[model samples]
Target chain A: MAKEVRLWEGNHLVAEAAILAGCRFFAGYPITPSSEIAEYMAVRLPQVGGTFIQMEDEIASMGAIIGASLAGVKSMTATSGPGFSLKQENLGYACMAEIPVVVVDVMRGGPSTGLPTHPSQMDVMQARWGTHGDHWIIALAPAFIHEIFWATVRAFNLSEKLRIPVILLLDEILAHMHEGFRLPDSSEIEIVDRAKPTVPPDRYFPYDESQGDVPPLAAFFSGYRFNITGLNHDKSGFPTTNPEIIQRDMERQRRKIERHLDEILWWDEHELEGAELAVIAYGSIGRSAHAAVDRARALGIRAGLFRPITLWPFPEKRVAALAEQVRTILVPEMNMGQLVLEVERVAAGRCDVVPLGKVGGIPIDPPEILEAIKARV
Target chain B: MAFDYEKYLRMERMPHMWCPGCGIGIVVKAMLRAIEKMGWSQDDVAVVSGIGCTSRTPGYLDFNTLHTTHGRALAFATGLKLARPDKHVIVISGDGDAAAIGGNHFLHACRRNIDITLIVVNNYIYGMTGGQASPTTPFGMRASTAPYGAVDPAMDICQVAIAAGATYVARGTVAQGLLLERYILNGLKHKGFSVIEAMSDCPVQYGRRNRMSSAVEMIQWIRDHGVPVTRAKELPPEELEGKFVTGELHVAERPEYTEEYRRLIEKAQKAAEGAHG
Candidate 1:
């Protein structure tokens, strides 16, 4: 059979890809810009013998996905700005409890529901630090419509394999866009499941790191009964106040992600062959940055694009390398200077770092980014 | 023969954090007895709780227990029940955890009529938080936050559960141990959402602030104020003033949520197959 091509909306593709990725449960509350994900899940999940629940609110939605995950179901939830804020508490719970869940925040204009229908990447930092305390997070920003499907599948893979929550960040534009793409065969996709304990129920510990950094997690009803608490806990998953245990466990959780950066971080570089200027962007604005880079190159300016697919665990070494090779790096984003802060820190005055920040609830067009690239060159 | 409570408990984790004379122990015993009577496999039961003194019950139980964030136990339990319909999911929460911050989840869970039993320990005060007034604190009850006495009217938890569409709604006091166990057992056996408002005592915090300064006095007060629902109806409003009606307050039959979803799945699968055909 020739490759089957289908026209799919971005949010609908996320729901479809979740099913293909073995996401068997979805719980969410309706919110603008991301509601289509929930709507499609409601219709599609049951068809695949999966469960979908419209929870009472965003907090409950987050809590439900965590619960489903603990019960050994691959689970997810999707929301927008205000809803994402409401999910922070349980999101933190998922972090502390080390439950693998996928949360999609289709970004819209916000400080507080500033613009409901328009696209904005204002939640770049929030995805990294929305939940309180020092916890590990893996956030992926996929630019293209087709990438959203694979990115969601990858989100589930990372979430389950690393035993941590994964945030897939999309702006309203990508969430609402329609595109025709080939659906890959099921045999072509790689799926990762959480490791199960080899020990009998008698000796099982939910957070044991002796086996590896990411402990094997047993399903709730799989004859392995263990405790899960939001409090700082010991390897047995019981709450503990011992400073030694707390310090060891907290460090282990961080190392679980940090040591695996080689597996977690992803980015793309374009035309960086002795380029004089590089434009760093992600999410919807990444498309504009790519266009502007090509335009600048056509205008006889040495411009390149560094689009980060994995926003967190920033591509420090690559961008720093780019900083050395290029005279200037222009970072354009939907929000007022979020990712640029990280870029600036990594550059450390080795090269000039400029930010083209916008929050007007619109995409930063190619010409605008090209103008920034021109000034720097 | 004496019952082996230790068989169901993680004895190493105790002595528990509950203060002396706390009625939470009584509620825990009743729940264990009910579960024991039901003969449930320990591995198949998942006990969940939110933040509060009562929420500590799950930490002691030797089951698949989850100590979740404050007021979200029901929300979490909902997901667990839906994901693993074969597992027996129960939630333990305090008045403030259930009816205050978790109030939205509480109402929606009842309305959804999912097959899960919720035990809300109504201690009338936020006992874990140094005796702050809770939603269940009586209008004139003294608490740390209600120094002059609580100005807000107390909530009738059983009534709220019944009105919110819980298929089984019951109230039992710690003063009535065996009866409390029976009510809990019935709630567990109910086919849909079951709410059991366990009227427990917070003698150390609530008792000291409200003049019932000892465990005995608090138990005695609850015993004196609790009238069986059948008898409560015989009394006039004036005669029933400042009293609570206990026992099984409401029972109705409804389609359980998970079972309904199973049917939905079958229909959806058929429709999808037909579309493909």
Candidate 2:
């Protein structure tokens, strides 16, 4: 088949990719920079025999997607900062219940509703820790319009494979940008569906860990009259207060991601061989970091760009290795140094960690990053 | 032969967490009886609930049960129903869970007229949190938060459901168990959004704070104040003060949300096929 090349807008590609990823249900409330995903899904989902619901609020959107997911459908919801805040409790429910659902938070400037129309990486930390409780999350930050499509696909795949909520972190620029990319043939794309129980309904346990860290999730109405709850539960999926059961399940939930970090972590590094200064960036800022690295190398600065596509689980091992190889790691982001803290924490005084933090709704331009790189040199 | 309650109850999950004389168990029994009367298999039903004593009903039910976050059971059930329209979906919520923090979802669920039956157990107070004044706490009722007296007017959940466009609306109390069961059965049969507000007793939290301290006293109070809709209509407005009318309060026909969406999908697919052909 001839490669199907096409030009695509950012948010529209998210909707298309989600469809390609077999997402049959979407429930979302409108929020700036992310509303286009919902709008596109509204028109597109029905055509593909999928369901799209414009829920009453962000909380409902999150809850709806989780519900759909529990009923054996791949589901997603999109939101920005304020909406993301409203979704925390339900997001925590998804995490606790071990339901597979994807949440896309198009980054916007905000502590509250700081800047709706502009972009920021303020939600970098929030995506991982926004939901209450002790749980690990897989968040992907796609740098370009094409990557947004693939990232959304991967988000669903990971969410299903791991039985956890995956966050697709897109900034305002990446969310609204236009770019061209070649679409893979249907056979070329990889799609993952959640594992189903091999045992009969009576023998099925929703959280049975004897199978593996990621238990088989029996869909509701699939002859599995099982219980799913937000409360701490045992393998039978009923709420339990037994200290040992609670601890084991909590540990298992954390290990579900931590044990598979290598499979879950994804990133692209440029020109890092024997580089002295490493520049770390993600999302829209990654575009600038790539350009800045090229500019720095042309000037004999030996600066490399390490863009983390999978932001959480934070690529700690690789970042620590980079710290050992490089003299300095310069972290640039749209927010006032969110992921940089992770870099610093992992770097752990092994190398000088410099943060080129930028807020106020402006993209960190290549020249600014280049200037920082030159100064580091 | 006695009703086989054990057939529907998760034997291991009992005895339930509700306080003694709490009417949540009665409401749950009524719901189970309704479910059984509908002739739906336990596997074909999905019982979802938010955070509350009433919301805990799903935990003890032998069905596809989901104990969701606070105030979001209806929203969650909305998605579940849309995904599996074949499955009978029901949301069990409490007064605070349905009318306070979750009020927006409740109103919107009614407005959407989705094929969902929401059984709002109106205990008048937040029993889970120990007698906090909820949106439905009666005026002048004593609660822990409103120690002096509840100054705010109580919300009539049935009226809210009716006004918000629910296709079927009914009010019943735990005192009239069979009536509540009948209303629930009717709600399950309704094609669109159905709200059955079961006025239940939170004897430990709500009744104790008010004058009715014992379970019998609370049940007597409920039995006394609940007037059948037919009799209440005959009584004058002043004579019906402080009395709630039981039985079906509202019924309107509209396109159910899931069915409408299915038609929409067919239309969209046809258009897409036409474009492709």
Candidate 3:
């Protein structure tokens, strides 16, 4: 079969990639910058014998996805800003319960509904610590239309592979941008299915830590009966308040993602081999920084770019290694210095970390990034 | 011969999360009886619940169950019903969970009229959270949050369901266990949205706050105070004023949400195929 390269909007690519990745269920309330995802799924899912429900609100949207996932389907929900806030509790539940589902947050300006139809990456920190409790999440920020398609596939793969809710953090620009992308054939895409218990139904335990951190999920009506509760539960899914069990359970939940950091972590590094000035960025801002890097190189300033694909694990080891070789790191984002703090903490005083912050519903200008790199040089 | 209730009960799991002498236990037993009489396989049933004392009913049942977040059981059950319409889907929730925090979802689920049975265990208070006044707490009834006496008018959940378009709506109390069981079985059998409000007692919080200290006292209050719909209809307009008429209050035939959705999809598919051919 001939490879088909097509011009697609970022949202359409994401929707198409999700369908190819076997996402049979999507429950999301439409929101700006992200509504196209819900719209595409509304039209496309039913054609493939899938389910798409527009929930009453984002909270119910998140809840429905969790339930659909338990029934042996790859489910997801998309939203931006305030809708993301409404989903925190159930996101915590998905984290604690180890339910595999994808959450797509197309970033917008906010503390609360600040800018509905504009671009801002203010949710960087919130995505990591928005939900209560100790949970390590896999968050990927795609810079271009092509990356949105692949990042969505990666999000589903990471969610199912680790049994954690993976987030695809797309900004308004990248989400709504139209660009050309090479659509991979179904055979070319690698899909990950949820782990299923090999143990007999009588011996199956829903939260069996000894059986490995990621237990196989049995679909409802699969003749494998198990309890799934938000409360601290034993191996058989029955609630237990024992301190020792609770301690071990919390550790297992954290370790499931932390232990597999190598597979979960991803990044894009450009020209950082022997560069003194490094620009750290992600999402749409990362694309802007890439252009700024090219402009700086044309001016004969040795500047490089480091974009984190996995935001939660923070890519600390990679950042720490890169920090040693760079004299100064310029962190430019659409938010008021959120990721700069992480870069500073990880850089550990080895390099000077500077943040070029913006939060008034505007993307960071490429010229500003160019100026920051010029100054560092 | 009467069914062996003890065999159905998971002895090791008890004493349950319910408070001592709580009517929730009785209501749960009634539900189990209804399930047994219907002869539905435990494996084929999926009980989804939200946070509250009533939501704990699924924890005791020997079936594939889910204990979900607060006030979201209906949403979760909707997904389950859509995914596998062949399975029996029952949502167990509290007055607060169903009518307060989850009020919008409750109304919309009724409006959708999907094939699912919802048992709103109305103990008249948020029992699990220490007797906070719920949407169904009686007017002028004392609660932890409403120490000065609840001045606001309480919600009538059955009326809300009936108005919201539930196909079958009924009200029963712990005092009417056999009748409550019958209502639950009927609700389960109904092919659309079926709501059974199981009036229960919260002796620890609600009972103490409202001065009905004992579970037996609460049962007596329900028995003496509840006016049957048939009897209320016979009373004069003046005599029947200001009283709650409890029974199978409403039953109607309506197209279920999922069935209608399927029909629309089929029609669209056939149209597309016809157009192409």
Top candidate, metric DockQ: 1
What is the TM-score (0 to 1) of chain A in model 3?
0.97
TM-score of chain A of 1: 0.98
Q: Check candidate 3 and list the clashing pairs.
A: none
For model 1 the local lDDT of residue B152 reads 96
Q: Give the CAPRI class of candidate 2.
A: high
Which ranges in model 1 have alpha carbons more than 4 Å from their true place? Answer: A1-3
TM-scores, one per candidate:
0.99, 0.99, 0.97
Per-candidate Cα lDDT values, in order, are 0.93, 0.92, 0.87
| DockQ of all candidate complexes | 0.94, 0.93, 0.68
Model 2 earns a TM-score of: 0.99
Over the stretch A42-80, how does candidate 2's per-residue lDDT look in tens digits? 999999899999999999999999999999999999999
| Candidate 3 CAPRI category | medium
Candidate 3 residue B30 C-alpha distance from true site, Å: 1.9
lDDT of 1: 0.93
Task: Report the lDDT tens digits of candidate 2 across residue range B74-115.
Answer: 889999999998789999999999999899999999999999
TM-score, predicted candidate 1 vs. hidden true structure:
0.99
Q: Is candidate 2 or candidate 3 better by lDDT?
A: 2
Model 2 chain B: lowest-lDDT 10 consecutive positions:
B239-248
